[model samples]
Structure formats: structure tokens, C-alpha cells
Target: MECAFCTDGIDHCHGTLVVHPDGGFAECTDPGCADLDRIRHGLIIDCHAVDPGCGCVPHGSLGPALRRAS
Candidate 1:
């Protein structure tokens, strides 16, 4: 599966779901991300981070790939 945040090949699923009271859904594996805001109304989804060799911290989001600092 392709990650929604980074659009990279997903090796594994995080099995976390953020659902709104109004029937909105967002899935994510990143524990650092706060889904409470999205759960209120909108949906915020986080995906497994892909190592792009940028040498950044291994966050569940694409922090390593998008970081300017190496």
C-alpha cells in the first residue's frame, strides 16, 4: 500500500484509526501526531515513514525524507 502522507511504499501497517463522530475516518501509524483535533471533525492520517537516506530522525511521518539538514 502507498502511504497517504509521503506516497511511499508501505512495508507494514500501523493499525491505528482516527474516526470522527460524524463518520469521518483517517488512518495513521505515527504516535507523535495528535489526532484528537482531526477526530473532532476532520481526519488526519499519518503513515509509516520511509527512509530516503537523508539521515534525519526516524519519525513515523516523512521527516527524514523532507528534512533539509542531513
Candidate 2:
């Protein structure tokens, strides 16, 4: 899931978040945010963990289209 701090390119903070399917945060970027969420809700921020991507799109469909358009 996109961090509320940087969703839609908003706050410009960038980091990978590991979110469970049930809306729980397994990892987060911001220090203050991570600490607060961890203490309050048992949310964790495993800095070593990396988020690859949401995998919504298996591959880039735009590449071919853009090449043809150009």
C-alpha cells in the first residue's frame, strides 16, 4: 500500500511499505510514523525488509504502445 505521507506523489517522502492483506503494516519508512504505529498497534517496521512492488501489472503494456506512437 502507498504510504499516506507519499501517496499520489503528495508529500515526496519515498519508501517501501510492507502491508498485510488485512490493512496491518508490517513495515514502514518514516521513523515517527513507524514508532507510533508500532507502539500503538503492534505494527512493525522491519527496515531490512524490502517491498518489491504491488504486482498489479505483471509487465509494462505501455512500452510497445509508446514505441508505436513515437
Candidate 3:
């Protein structure tokens, strides 16, 4: 569920897979590959598939998440 984004110092841009209310996981590739700001705000834009067999979803299907209050 958790991903390390950076190889150096306090890894930046880490991401966690968002599970839907139904228990289905959102599209994701590497956890660390997603944007930090997007992840923080739940606005995941890219698919960081954790499993090699995982497939990507269409950009249109990947809806944006609501931004969280800082």
C-alpha cells in the first residue's frame, strides 16, 4: 500500500494505493513514482502499478481525487 519515491534522503513523493469503499484498489504503479502533492491531496494522476502483472487504466477512467485541506 505504501511506496518509496526517492532513492536518497528522506524519500520524497511517496504514494499509497487508494482503496475504494468496495475494496477495489485504484490504479497505481510504483508507490514512489507518483507526485507527492497529488498523493497528499489524493489527486493521483498517474498509474503506479505495484504488480508486474498489473495493467493500467485509461486516463479518463482515472478520476481525480478531492484535494485535502492542508
Best by TM-score: 2
lDDT of 1 at 34: 52
Tens-place lDDT digits, model 1, residues 1-70: 7555346542333334433223444444456555434332222322333223222323442422221111
- The root-mean-square deviation over C-alpha atoms between each candidate and the true structure, in angstroms, is 15.3, 13.4, 9.2
What TM-score against the true fold does each predicted structure earn? 0.20, 0.24, 0.21
The whole-model lDDT of each prediction reads 0.35, 0.36, 0.39
- Off by more than 4 A, model 3: 1-8, 14-19, 29-65
lDDT of 3 at 19: 36
**Highest lDDT, which number?**
3
Q: What TM-score does candidate 1 reach?
A: 0.20
| Candidate 1: residue pairs that collide | none
Clashes of each: 0, 0, 7
- List, residue by residue over 1-70, the lDDT tens digit for candidate 3: 4344333344343344443333344533355565433334323433422233224443345445433323
Give the C-alpha lDDT of model 1: 0.35
The residue pairs in collision within model 3 are: 5-32, 28-48, 28-49, 29-47, 29-48, 29-49, 30-48
